[model samples]
Target: MEIDFLLVGQGLAGTALSFRLMEKNLKCILIDTPLANNSSRIAAGLYNPVTGKKMVRTWMADYLFPEIEPFYEKLEEFLGKNFLIKKNIYRPFLSVEEQNEWMGHSSDPLLQPYFEKIHTQALYNEVNNPYGGIMLKNSGYLDINTLLDAYASYLIEKEMLMQEEYQEDFLEVTDLGIRYKEIKAKGIIYCNGLGAMNSKYFSNLPFAPVKGEILDIHQDFCPNVIINRGVFRISLPNGLQRVGSTYSWHDLDTGPTERGKRELLEKLEKLIFIENKKIIHHKSGIRPATKDRRPFLGKHPGLESVYIFNGFGAKGVSLVPYFSKIMVEFLLNGIEIQKEVNISRWNQT
Candidate 1:
């Protein structure tokens, strides 16, 4: 079988790129392995424009935020599924000083787009917000599982998805393109998350993998918006509230740990006053982070038709949609990728 591109991995990175390629009427095939610990599958799926302890706007928030809803809405229409949850994010201030600082930020034109409202007084009676918090607009979580599953079905129906492990050894790089057994493609792009670390071409790139754990707990407190402070608490369907996530670099092999659970509960206690919360599930996955915390995007230095589109790390939900368009443009139009994200920053292409 011959195709234009062979995408490795069907996680958010692969899914977004493949979908964009198909939208442009480009022929491609995706090879994926559904691992129990796939990062995208187990991710919190939260996309907050304002993040961190300083509550500063995230990197490239201006570019990434606008593309998110429009991109996902189109996917939803195509798949006939509802997975985008456009809810506000409520982040409580740690102190009165912080609250006052945000009051000034509310007027900053650069920050005004994401600012919903700055509450000086407590917004909810059930929560602990003595200094109140900031309500951010254009912030929410995607139902990643629903999106991935629906897209997988769409790919399968179109004969563009192969649900199996991709053996790198079988791949052959030629002057024309690439060959994997009977499959021939004009180019091959690696969107396989940390799986790229094992590839011969990408192993040299610095990939700082970090493992994160999240919990699903049954609680009566259901807020319309996501509560994010020390730890984020997102209200899901039914009586369950999704709370997470702790980052660890050493404990990559282990799944969810008792230490991670304790850390989450301890953080949760500081954010809200709750009683008798039942833990329904605990899951974890290794993020394909980089030393510089930017995504890796570009063609291989030596191989003409080989490329990579991975390493969005914890911010994949926000980064993928925008960068996927950029990647597709580079692939089809020979447009030069931005130096910041291009892998050639490390190696000359």
Candidate 2:
């Protein structure tokens, strides 16, 4: 079959790309192999406005959030699914320094737009609250795994996906175009998450893969909203909650580790009481973190028809809706790609 585009890997990047392509009435086939060790499959699908220890709002929040809101809603409508929801987050202040930290920044105009002034509260006085926190608005979570499964099913039903290993050798590229198996395609895009760590075509870019561990705890009582502290908790509709997510840049193993569990528990102990809880699941997955920590997008310098859309890192939840839409426009129309995220930065280096 002849097609307009051929995509490799069906994780968030590929899935998002295919969705947009189909929206443009493009004929595209996705070749997916059961993901190797680490991809976006295990992502918590979290989007935090203030990140890191300093609590700075992410870049381009003014532009990104509004674009992402309706995109996921549309996905929910199309798939008959409901993974994305708005639940307020409770950010507990760790110490007096932390409270002073928030107060010191109340005058900053850039941060003011993202949230309101800190209000005093004692939700966990018995637990730990040297100070309190300001509630963040316009933030939420995405059920990444749910979206992936639903999209996979949609592709299978439409015969738009293949379950097999995608070897680059199968892609016969020439001055004219590209070919794979029996089909000819105008362009081929690789949205494989960490798999690009070793892709011969785009591996020249500074790609950093980080391994992270997530813990599922079944407890007697838990808050419906996501709670932020030393360790954050996102509530699942399934009644279980996801926590921890310690990032390890050195070891990229997928096996559950006792160290991550103990570390997360040590942090959790400072606040909530963990008396009678069942440790249901513990697994590790790697994210395609980039060197500068920005997403890597756009086309390859050498290969004209091959493209990439990866390096979402931990912010896949928010980045997906914004960047994916932009990518679709760049492909369907003659729109100029964002320079900061373009893979061409590494060009001529």
TM-score to true structure, per model: 0.98, 0.93
Any idea what lDDT model 1 has? 0.92
lDDT per residue for candidate 1 within 106-191, as digits (tens), equals 78999999988999999987788988999999989999999999999988999888888899999999999999878999999999
Evaluate residue 13 in candidate 1 and report its C-alpha lDDT on the 0 to 100 scale.
95
Model 1: residues with Cα > 4 Å off, grouped in runs = none
Question: What C-alpha lDDT values do all the predictions have?
Answer: 0.92, 0.79
Indicate which candidate wins on lDDT: 1
Q: Write the per-residue lDDT of candidate 2 for residues 298-332, one digit (tens) a residue.
A: 87787778788999888887887889888888877
| Worst-scoring 10-residue span by lDDT in model 2 | 121-130
Model 2, 86: alpha-carbon shift in Å?
1.4
- The TM-score between candidate 2 and the true structure equals 0.93
Q: Which whole-number lDDT from 0 to 100 does residue 122 have in model 1?
A: 93
